[model samples]
Target: MPNALIIGASRGLGHEFVRQLAGQGWKVFATARNDAALEELRGVGAHACKLDVARPESLAGLGWQLDGESFDLAIYVAGVFGPREGAKSAPTRQDFDLVMHTNVLGAMQALLLVAPMVEAAKGKLVFISSDMASIADASSSYGWIYRSSKAALNMAVRSAASDYPGATFAVLSPGWVRTDMGGENAPLEASESVAGMLDVIAGLKPEESGAYRNYAGKTMPW
Candidate 1:
């Protein structure tokens, strides 16, 4: 069975990835911050670990726990949508910290730990980014902080790709899916978005490493 690791499997896109991958008979190692979420992942046939991406110590423990394991696929899906404020509305210090730490810093840290494992298996590494992170496509300043964080994440993944040539890296945008973060009226469904992303991942080539694409496989502007 192909081995896969999901960095954040608690809910939304992360949980959806677990469900689909596990149901397809992949040996999935997943992580969540809460006990209940962990249990849910277990119920879905995933080997679940307790992890809070915002906590460096928790991530350190995850690195130790997953030591020596080679994953055919590893995804960094832990992120938070911070204040829904515009450019004029400054985010509070706490919100800024929380958003940046979870979305950018945590991902950067996880990449350092997970990239080698993916390289060992010659696998693919995916970072769940957002279309809002696109600089050329920017139409508004809404969720400025969150957008900035993801943009930083995009750059981080792109820069890291050259160092880990054995593994392919992708930064994907899942679109406006109806999740806790996307709210109820979003056009896409979690299942649809994830399925599309899976297809995109399956078709990824090493030459495409660090490419930013949408769930539907359309390349996006950086």
Candidate 2:
């Protein structure tokens, strides 16, 4: 069975990825901050671990724990939608810091630790970015902090792509799915979004490294 690691599998899209991958017979390493949720993922045949993406020490410990093991697929799904209300001025410093730490720094730190593992397996690395990160596609001003964080994440992955040529790297936008972050009124369901992303992931080629694509496999402007 192929091996996969999903960060932030406590709920929503991350949890769905764990469930589906385990169902498909993959050896999954799922992480979540909540012990109960980690246990739930464990019940689904995943090797669940506790993770707090915002902490460097936590990531360092995880790297030690997984030493010598490699994964065929590594997906970073940890993020926070900070301060939902868009402001005309700017998000408070606290909100900006929290969002950037969880969304951008966490992904970068995870990549630093996982890059060698990915190179060892010659697999793929995927960062779950957002469509709102696109400067070209921007028309609204909402979620500016969330938007900027993802944009930084995209840039981070693109820069790391060349560093790990053995592995395919891509940033994916899951679309406005009906997750807790996306809200109940969002048109796409969690399962539907995850399923489409899985299809897109299955078809990813090494040549397509650094590409920004949506759940439907359509390329998005950087």
Candidate 3:
């Protein structure tokens, strides 16, 4: 069985990934920020750990704890939707900081810490990015903070791919799935989005590194 590590498996897309991957016989190590959530993840048969991706100390501890383990897949799935008010409205400093620190810095930090393990296994490193991050496809003037964070995330992952040639690194847009972040009005369900992503992951190639792709494995603009 392939060993997989999923960061931020407390809920939503992260939790769904744990559920599906475990069902498919992958040996999954999942992380959440709290014990209750970790327990919930454990319920789905994933080995759960506590992690606050934005914190350097937490990442350091995690790196130490998993010292010799190698993972076939490692995904950074933690993010925040900050200040729903669009580009027109100015967000408080706290909300803006929260979004950037959690999405961009947090993901980058996690990837840097785990890259060695992923590379050792010649595995895939996936960052859960967003279509909103697409500078080449921007049509809306909303969620600038969230948009900017994910945009930075995409760039960071793309840059990391060049540095970590042994690992297949890519960003994925999970579509408007009906999760807590996507809201009730969103069209697609979490299952559908995760299933598509699993299919894409199953067929990942080293040559596909640095690409921004959708859940269906189609390339998206960076």
Task: Provide the TM-score for each candidate, comma-separated.
Answer: 0.99, 0.98, 0.97
- Over 1-222, each residue of candidate 3 has an lDDT whose tens digit, in order, gives 999999989999999999999999999999999999989998999999888987889988888778799999998899999877787898899998899999999888888888889999999999999889999999986888899999999999998898999899989999999988999999999999999998998788999898899998889987
User: Which of the two, 1 or 3, has more lDDT?
Assistant: 1
Candidate 2 structure quality by residue, lDDT tens digits, 140-201: 87888998899999999999999899889999999999999999999999999999999999
lDDT per residue (tens digit) for residues 56-102 in model 1: 99999998889889999999999999899899997899999999999
Model 3 TM-score is 0.97
Q: What is the TM-score of candidate 2? A: 0.98
Backbone clashes in model 3, listed as residue pairs: none
Q: What lDDT is reached at residue 82 by model 1?
A: 86
Tell me the spans in candidate 3 whose CA falls farther than 4 Å from its real position: none
Candidate 2: residue 214 lDDT (0-100): 98
Residue pairs that clash (backbone atoms under 3 angstroms), model 2? none
Q: Judging by TM-score against the true structure, name the best candidate.
A: 1
Q: Rank the candidates by TM-score, best first.
A: 1, 2, 3
